[model samples]
Target: MPEYGPLHGETVIFTGTLKSLEVFDLVRQYGGVPVSIPLIQVNEVEEPTDEKRMKTCSDFDWLIFTSQNAVKAFQSKMERFAISVNEIPCKIAAVGTRTAAALEKIGFTVEFIPTVFSADVFVKQFKPTDGELNVLFLKGSLAGSIIREELPFQVVEWTVYETGAKRDSINSLVDLLKSRRDCSVLFASPSAVRVFSEDAVPSVGWSGYTIGAIGHVTERALLEAGATVDVKPEIYTLKELVETLSNRKDEFR
Candidate 1:
């Protein structure tokens, strides 16, 4: 087990997509107890509309994927269209390592990736060519436009997946937080923070536990919901978050 200090003996709760368990195991190795309470469920929306599919593939100079869910959903749509990932002509960009890994798994090489895996950094790096650099953004329906709003290119947004709060799971998280005196909560997205805060804010008093946010947006959401943020990783990835917490375990102790 890898050693981490500041997180030693802390109980951490995860509330988002558990695409990979590497982060969870790292937390435990660093002496932090990891708890997974999924607050948002991802559902794929697949309907064969030629107009939308054609526009996604043909009209875009750059295809941007923000999440792994988007990659999977887009891949599924591409299969329906009889389009292969290797055959695509446009440049591919992924917001984070996870999404980039998904693209790599599907045989598509990512041409652009930001240092920090956020829309702000991505927009800073995005240089649109003249004469309508059509960009196809594959992301969740509820995702905010930190990238879309700032891009100089002609952006076409597509909701490849929908995110909704898991209401039943909220009670369990509240109960766990209430019972445990020393525990931390992890928020991966602004939506998860919003959903969890809507009910969890009133149910569990915020003073006893630590809150870990993945990025600036998530931290802002957590703060807006009246919860104090204890940890936020500089890099916007789960692996980095776990590692940073592991390395700085003594701070929380």
Candidate 2:
């Protein structure tokens, strides 16, 4: 028989959209049975002003992306406007490793990534040159004001995408929680935590499951929602979250 990993037959439930199979594979590699209960959907914002901004993207000194969704939306807009990668002359900043990898995959060079994956750390650690810099933050509608409010540089935020709860997944998730209390549930964003809290918690309650959050922000959301965060990765990535959860399998067991 093949050797099972630490998770060994544990059900790992993801409460957000699958960005890629990386997290799922990681969970499976650790002997966890990964399950997807997508509770959020992200869609690019299509507006005339957005196109205008993309057209003059080179006007900014820096382009900042705080999430992979922003990178995806930015890439879609770039293709829509026939804007080539070489046409964008501004330096790029990504908040996390996955976000940086996404930007790099699109042939764009990422000039800055903070020591940590959070915006609060990003503002503190990201040291740009001493000058008047016009920075454009490409973000989602649900993004917080940290980048805009904290950064010392002249920052203009463009909402490139919007996040909404996937109402259809509520029933499915509630059903899973109702049936299986041993599952380790992972939340990637505050949006997903909110959806699970508002829609699923009232029905099934989240006490029995092993709650996992990807980052501090999401962990705060879970705490605010009155759910105890059982597993949280210090690195704030889905793969890390899974590995962290797997490492704590004994605690949950």
Q: Each model's TM-score?
A: 0.90, 0.96
Error of 1 at 241 (Å): 1.4
**Counting only residues 3 or more apart in sequence or on different chains, how many pairs clash (N, Cα, C under 3 Å) in candidate 2?**
0
- Tens digits of per-residue lDDT, candidate 1, 37-58, equal 9999998886667436754585
Per-residue C-alpha lDDT of model 2 across residues 127-209, encoded as one tens digit per residue? 78758899999989988898899888899999999999898988887887778746888999999988888888989776887
TM-score of 1: 0.90
Give the best candidate by TM-score.
2
Residue pairs clashing in model 2 are none
Overlapping backbone residue pairs in candidate 1 total 6
Provide the lDDT at 191 for model 2. 94
The stretch of ten residues in a row with the least summed lDDT in candidate 1 is 47-56
Task: State the RMSD for candidate 1.
Answer: 2.3
**Every candidate's lDDT:** 0.81, 0.88
